[model samples]
Target: MDIDVNDSTPPAPEEYPDVDGEPPAWAEDRTPLGDAIPWFRKFQGGMHTKEGILYGLLISGDAGVRSYIDDEIIITRTGGSSERDAEGKLSQVADQKDDTAISRSVNNSMKFNIAVGVVIGKKNKILKRKLPHAFNVMDYFRVAYVWHERIDGFIAVRFRLEKLELEEKSWWAEKGSPAPPRTARRKWVKPIEHICGACAQTYYRIYMQGWMCLNTSCSQFWKLPDGNDPPVELDYDPKWLDWRHDPSDEVQPHYSLVPDFMSVIDDSDPNSTYSRTSWKNGIVCPSCKQCLSRRFWDGWRCDESCGFKRVLNMQTISLRAVVDDYEVAPIRRAIVFDPGPKETALIEPEIDDVYSHPYRRLVFDLPGAGTVTHFVTNREINAKPNGPNDLFIQLQQANLGLRRYPLSQAGMPYGFVVAVDSLPFSEACDPILRVMGRLTWATHEATDKQGVTALIPNELLALGYFEDMAINYHDDGEDTLGPTIASLSLGAMAHKSLRMKYKYYNGFTKGSKKLVHDDPVLEGCANRDWRLDLKQKLDNNELDWPAYEAEWWRTYKANKSGAAREAPPCIKTQLHHGDLVVMHGDGVQKYYEHQVELEKGGGAKLRYALTARHVLPAKIEPGQWPKGQFQLTKDQDYKGT
Candidate 1:
């Protein structure tokens, strides 16, 4: 079949604008209604508040709920949680109860003289028009009317909202069906006001048939004076629907449609005077004008695919300046050597006169786990050429292609960059390899009592942290990974802590609610009295090891309803510049997890962590192996001193 390739080829698909891949031309010049205002949770229902002030309201057109929307007016039903019976099945005929706090807040907005931003959900069938975005911002609105109404035998609170700027043209108006002229005023009619004899609550005669006490709390609620049943079919008074709101000059919102990003300190500024918290808020893209959350470690990027990205230029800071700024406190050694069964304190090793090394070696042993060795580097390594200071500068200048990675199932990227197997042992990575070699040697000496072989690292993970960035508690436990893991710290000082994993931390069972297990469990935590009592029983020979374990489980199951508590850190220490840390034994990874956080206060603006690990070759796919080999040159290798 000798057919011409050009003849057989299909013509290029008709090109319309790539709506998802590219921003429209008008996106840069015109501001989007949704982006101009602060919408914290755009997709959620109910009201949105900022700084304890109600600022926005989200209305969705749910079934059996009446929510009408036009150009200038919107009549919406209040949100309520679904009621369920004793059998856990949803109730059919019961009235949905509104959150008491939310109802009170919404009712009091008028009294507080607050104007709320209105955003309409696309599910609103009353809109009768498709919207360009998932949600359409209909400008600021003031609550014109609020009253309790009975719908389908259930009491529901209804709100009537009028556009604040009545003269302005509505953004949702279409050419085929234009919005009614704002200048045309509706005839105003005052509804007859009634005072309930039982509750003394003032209500309006909204229905043409009759008036009744609408207050749910009153004994005469929804009851007529004649003691007759109210009509199931009700008709609203035409006059009440035609009520008009007079323009008011009092209602003013605290936030503006377009937030002023230029007024604040520029994030790209070289000076380190500003706190990282200042730039943590959402940023408005200069190219697309769309607001984006701070998702990247280096800087901000337009998620709308506007091809706009701003990478922050970080400068290496002096360690002396950082120490001065932090008011360097004296390092504290572990006070409790042994935790004595009941306590969860880390057992610090005694620094006896053994092997005399240049750096101070501090080893912390974890019972039933492994050991954590901390090699506190001397002044020579901290200040020498091609040392921590130089290495920090080299990392800053090198293009390591570091970025935050999505390590969890949720797909949300981390706050800090985790560049794994990207930089080999060469040039910028030479110092890391040198430190890893020293750590391997130190690990062998430290774990001599345990008789564990020191594993030489074949893989490296370089992590970069900006101000306010941190790595949360997680284990590097993988089937392919060897027993030993080592890391070298550079630039800013950090606090590294290792803790034992709690059994009920993730969950007691599948789909069960996870227990709160954060550090510093002062109150609402499961008391340690049970453990102390059990330990006493064992010490008195009342129970053996197996019996003791069985009794512990029995007590744990019995007190399962008690608040969950996290185990305190077994080893807590500071990792200064040029410091090397190592963890030996697979049990360490299985039973414990570690976290690293940058020291607070106006300290160094940047930090780098290079961790080395050994990956079993047989576990990896043959085709997925990394290209090129890394070798530690003789000069680059470090042997103790």
Candidate 2:
């Protein structure tokens, strides 16, 4: 359960914001909330636990946040195994009846920071009376509200470097000139005509336009345009479309947990809360200096990564182990780290600020360092022993390198504890493991314009096959999203529902037809409750979307700006190993209202293709924004949408 610092009083249903069970019809047009972006920017070593937040707002002029003496948070660095004061100066320690306290680090360096920035541990439920950061530091207490976790624990850096960056006043956004449009596309040459000498029998103009047989029966009857012998173009419009191609075998489900987000409900607090936000989101415009975005949990964020990223921490609740007797892996880690790159100037977004803009911006803009601290607490229910080791086994079972792991590493080398923000590979991950392979190989090597190698000879055949079956429909518009298109399974597979998606924007109002409450928006559509609403956001144009839903996107403005608050989606999930499921693109319930029904006990972890046709403009730098990754929010400084 989550505890909201804004409201001191613990809330019940009466105090809770009235959450509706349904959304409007036009909600379909809203973009699916940008998927979460993992946090791996930090160069965090091993550590757990976070202190209170100390915030200082950025005012005008030459004035700035003071150092530890003045405007700074004034944290006292007191370190020790059992010492609680700044400098770890405690002399004596008390014994506990049971294991009341965690095993403190014995190494002098492992001692906790003695200086006191602000103590925001769960012990004291708030970043209150502290430096006054934008967000409620206490929010990290509940598992529901923590950031993504790494397997053993979270990957976090020390506070010293983080403090250094804070004092540097380097908190700024980035800017860039848009790239020239990709023009000069290939001219779609037309097909040619061929005439027989005597019988005048026609034959396909294969020599001129290749064998695009318009009519199978008249294979040799090649049609002509006006008087042009070999037309550069041929009939391909919907009006003149024909032909069929066989598709490959259906790809199975590759489920993935919307990282950093374990569940909707916050079980820590009595409120039984739900965190609507996640880490697997997109890259925003030149925001933080660090181009921090990653997969899997890395220890620390890049130096330039934002400081006040809300890190949610929690352990997975194994359904199989209802009682404490069963072992439960309290943690399965996945982090979103910062990757330093675009830290020059402020580049504001060009779209409207929706949902809660000012608050989100402040929360996002807070200049500090990012960290991922993770630990486990055994809260045995009914006084039972939850299998810790066994629980850990379940957690790592589906990881990429699960097979190459050690259960009890008494003296084994720690596996590569990579920060997802860094490149994702064992020395070879960064460049080789890219969504788009090298644009070009070495000088001696060969590749296509797009950097494709000749080794994949089967690619041509696969493309032709997919295109053919894509349009080849025989059933009576059967109204089902069957013949599932290609699905790319990364690892943990799960979410495969026959749904469709149609995004809308700024289309929410009391009685708008698109806002119709809780009814099916489209004919034959099932599970239409996932519809989203962006009535608050201003439209963004930095990245010209290849396509849009309903073409109804309108200019918008920030209703307000304060603290960023994300309401978790009811459908977000984490995938398990060896799981496979299938869903079609047409009925995907992309934008419009949609419902998701689990197949009894068969509901496995959730999955997303991460294969949305999101294309970046040319201006995006290769070194900065990794391939297959983009931002959901507008940049840092733009004024209008």
Candidate 3:
């Protein structure tokens, strides 16, 4: 799997691709191949290692240490900071530190004869030539030598890498030309080796000026002969820079530089199991051979417009079988009722009342926040045809145009984005209408006792999760949203948990970076006695909020580092098919965030979370408003059953 130069270019566009479609902005500059292929992926540092084994080297000319490529050899420096003195200034080169993890990995690779892939950054000045790509993937090489060197008054590790294949022509050279033969180039001589009398360490005379005891532990380290002062800076000896290693038997790489992308999954076999972890990795486009990240929900599409796309055809599974598989699990024998250290309790009906009604209700009242209510439905509610099972299958086959969107400027887009009314408001199909109706009923039931009016949901977000897919902790407290939000769980069983906001638990301001107050006397948070004392002071009006905040900072600074600790979940429960979870009150989202994790190793391969929210019409833009009238007919309304 050598990447040919032509493979990077996209194919020519069709004569009339699309009347309204603009040409795709194919990326010309090279970018990090992040999990696009198995062999090579993006890494942070100059060296890439896995489990203490060096796998690749990123050579850049802009590093602090000198690095260069000459013929078939690469001379690069290791990574680490110099030792600082008591005054915080860097120490002499002899006192520099070279014991970094990357340096150790380089030494390990040299000792183990591990072949490492080489990538050349465009900014490299060693070759004094511009590269065709920002990051050019070179062939693999073996760590030929490892040594310690002094650079800018600091000790640094250096590696000498030699190309594994000696007979192949170097890609950087002129077309059809191999490296200049040793006999054809200028004559070169090897540098003299010096033995240190003080430390008994062998040293190479690589400096242009002279040689000294290179060992840092020796008294004569960096000392020139006859007390001759060493140059303020050092330069490599031209003869040493020109030195080359003798040709050896060709060594093969353990893996190809570009792994086969088509083998990621058997696309032809629709019945095969597809784990989220396996399919989440990017794929190499078969047409342009460019590495593409898995950005879209449906499939991989080449951004270069090479006319290559792969959409996975996942089959709809039975929700009944999924519930059956979950019940068989060992952990399902007893329901999880973790009250956490703060004693936030989980309340449920007695055994007699549990199965009496159309649905069983469970509730957890969060401290200083609103309630989280779960309506556990009966088996009749989850039956086939117009039930959760039918809804799950229909949603899977619907053309909702669901996809993932980037939450921030960097990193991969995570979690499926909201799929709003894709059709006219008056024309929404049964599946969407069913979820909205159920959520509406649940929201009203959960909030009516509190004298809070329920808001009819205008938007529904249908998110699909494969094996191990999950939604991280986030709040639904948006200005445009109503106080209550409800969701319907379908397919595989999922575990949902709610936790106090970090700022609320730690009493620290997230944006201002200040210790503003003591903990809010929550049940599960740390420092209970301190929080209680503060609460008492506030109750008595002996201290106001500002005064208490100042006192808290003073007291906390004396014993703490002002670091925030993660708050544990106060409410946790499992959500099965036909389960309705209603989070009522603005305080719930304001004080807490929730997350949902799908059950792994299940009978159903997919789970769908259809959440409905009341989107205020005043907040929507004029152009974004729905075209048709929005109204739910009598038949679309759902009762408690």
Candidate 4:
């Protein structure tokens, strides 16, 4: 959970004046007899009183509080008598248990800053108190009534404190062009009522380095109080020039990932459709950065004779499609990484987080998406152990809503479920997180663009592709989706293809076409609740694999067409095991759709992919979803109707 600090000022006497000097106006008659307790004042209050105290704390510039309850609270179980000072205030308790309930409550109240003592063997040799730097002395705890549980924990007295020489003043002063007269003085930055840049409406304490404007209607970009200059653009290497052309599988090589199966038609034969110049307009090699021209049969060859060859299974093209010849774009769109080899071990280690799953692998892909990064995390889970080496296999299974989604004319090639802020950092996940951040920054040196910075991944998709399962063409064009999507492929080698959406060349003809467009909003779709039936059938042993395939095919054929209308052939790329694919550029997700399919004749029976995205903030809240333990849907970032 993100940390939220209270920063407000107390109201004036007239605004919430003490009625007859008894209490603040709102607290006068309405104050319950139970509320007379002093300790509970820190936590329980209505809207007005809550703001009142928060404002008081901020105006006083106090960074923290040193709370002291009655000695009875700490020494009750030990039968110790309470003592008092000359002022009649309860003295600090002498008899205290480290493991008592009171100790736990205090520790959990805030994210405390601490100084560790030297460790002697398994225990600390000494301990010392390390207070916040903004702490200053004040007495606000004298107003509470000293009662036991009836008064919400007896508070004998408490002290408010401010840190000496607070350092944030200079920073706040720099935000204003000419520091305002009121702001010129260095005291405390209270909950200032300022107008939002987007809607010109007043907001309370909503300025920060990584916070968005509080205006819900405006949807303005995130900006800091002082302002920020857009990032610099990445300079392109001269060697990575544009080399795209028309695509066709007729002259491309065909290879099987499992077996050494490759075939090339003899161009010398008179009946051959392709000759020595067949691959003149082929794409570049994904393995090596060389252009793969169509000169040989089977697969295209690198012009420099790099010897990089593979089946023309899928053409690797830019994230955005090349509608015409005048387009100048990046030669390569996705990147493939190699992590050497896998280690053979018994019971593969899986690290647990707060979520239902664990970190199944060690590869991460972080892509710079203008201002923030879109990161990928790969995790694997299984019901049963594949072998003795699979230590992370789960005997207890939890469903994270992974299911197939329907596209315009085809379905997603694999099962996928999007996770919203679900993955938490742990010992196993932290290393990858750190590495990805550094790698993304390194990549920005060559790919950075103005007005863009690396952002954290907000959504995760756990995708599974069974044998013969495949996803069709679909662009992630949801308004909530970010400009980039990064994915890490694991398990089996799968064919990931990106196809250009069909738009008529003639404006007049476009108006007459009735092409099917998948609704971007996925709320209330059949896929949401439909997956439960499939899961139930599988669990109950009532599903027949052969019958399932036959039924799916029947539905596929009836989905308005055997295939989506052809505009142009698709560009393909191979996602080998442990490869990372970062689809950059805002135009990419806007103009193109992609699919993941099982490579024909591949050795592995299943493939898995972990794809990460930055969903819009409006859709991340769970309260907007259906009332249930789990909600599964095909829609990407769909807001409820």
Q: How many clashes in each candidate?
A: 0, 146, 3, 35
After superposition, candidate 1 runs with Cα above 4 Å error: 1-47, 57-109, 118-138, 143-162, 172-175, 183-193, 204-216, 222-245, 262-268, 271-274, 303-305, 311-316, 320-356, 405-449, 504-507, 510-561
* Stretch of 10 with least lDDT, candidate 3: 406-415
TM-score of 1: 0.70
Error of 3 at 224 (Å): 6.0
Choose the strongest candidate by TM-score: 3
Model 1 C-alpha lDDT per residue in residues 1-641, reported as the tens digit of each score? 13222345432323211111221111221123333356423334467755444577865444234456666677766556444457553223546444565566566666566787776555545556554455545577777777775665777777777777767556765434444555556455677788999899988876666778888888887776776656755555555655556765477765664465435645455443223543344556677656554445555677656788766654444555544334332232222344445455455664532352656677777655677877777665555666666677776666665655421110011122342333334434555555556555655665664676665566666777656768888888888777887778876688988776664232222345333222222211244466657766877889876787677667878887455556677677888777788888777887678899988866435677877677666776654334213565776666655
Error of 4 at 108 (Å): 77
Highest lDDT: give the candidate number: 3
What lDDT score belongs to each candidate, Candidate 1 first?
0.59, 0.21, 0.64, 0.31
Quote the lDDT for 608 in model 4: 49
Per-residue alpha-carbon lDDT of candidate 3 for residues 1-641, written as tens digits (9 for 90 to 100): 12223335432322212211111111233332545534445445566777676787777644444566754678877654544457554333443344667777777777776788877766665654445555666677888767665666555666778776655556655334445554445354666788887788987776667777767667777777655646655566665665545545334455666666557565444324345644456666666656665555566777655778888775555555555553422321234454444345433322222432456677677656778888876566666357776787887776666554321110011122342234455556667777777888888887776688887666666677767778899888877777788889987789998888887777776768565343456665556567678778977899988897777777677667456677777777888877888888778888788999988774335677877777666765655456323566666677765
Ten consecutive residues with minimal summed lDDT in candidate 2? Answer: 458-467
Stretches > 4 Å off in candidate 2? 1-131, 135-521, 525-641
The order by descending lDDT is: 3, 1, 4, 2
Give me the overall lDDT of model 1.
0.59
Which whole-number lDDT from 0 to 100 does residue 180 have in model 4?
24
Which is the better candidate, 3 or 4, if ranked by lDDT?
3
